[model samples]
Target: YYQEEFAIRRTLISCLDWCDILRIWDVDALL
Candidate 1:
């Protein structure tokens, strides 16, 4: 159970990181 929880947390963090990168790219494209 602990390992599963850790994996889920890591996946969430990675997804958030990707979202931030995409947002930055979108802003740069608009400019």
Candidate 2:
């Protein structure tokens, strides 16, 4: 159970990074 929970947290962090990258790309395009 602990390992599964850790994996889920890592996946969530990865998605957050992707979201940040997308936001930055959008801002760059706007500029």
Candidate 3:
């Protein structure tokens, strides 16, 4: 269970980072 939680946390971080990058690109395009 500990390992599963660690994996989930890592995945969430990666997803958040990807989302941030996408948002930045979208804003740049709008500007």
Candidate 4:
């Protein structure tokens, strides 16, 4: 259970990081 929880947290953080990066890219494209 602990391992699974840790994996999920890592995945969530990674996904959030990707989202931030994509948002930056999208803004750059618009400008």
TM-score of 3: 0.86
**What is the C-alpha local distance difference test score of candidate 3?**
1.00
| Weakest lDDT window of 10 consecutive positions for candidate 1 | 1-10
> Which of the numbered candidates is closest to the native, going by highest TM-score?
1
lDDT of 4 by residue, 1-31 (tens): 9999999999999999999999999999999
TM per model? 0.96, 0.94, 0.86, 0.92
Give the distance in Å from residue 10's predicted Cα in candidate 2 to where it truly belongs: 0.2
On a 0 to 100 scale, what is the lDDT of residue 10 in model 2? 100
lDDT of 2: 1.00
Q: lDDT value for candidate 4? A: 1.00
Clash pairs, candidate 3, are none
lDDT of 2 by residue, 1-31 (tens): 9999999999999999999999999999999
Cα lDDT tens digits, model 3, 1-31, are 9999999999999999999999999999999
Q: Assess candidate 1 and give its lDDT.
A: 1.00
Q: Where's the lowest-lDDT run of ten residues in candidate 2? A: 1-10
Q: Give the range where candidate 4 is weakest over 10 consecutive residues by summed lDDT.
A: 1-10
lDDT of each: 1.00, 1.00, 1.00, 1.00
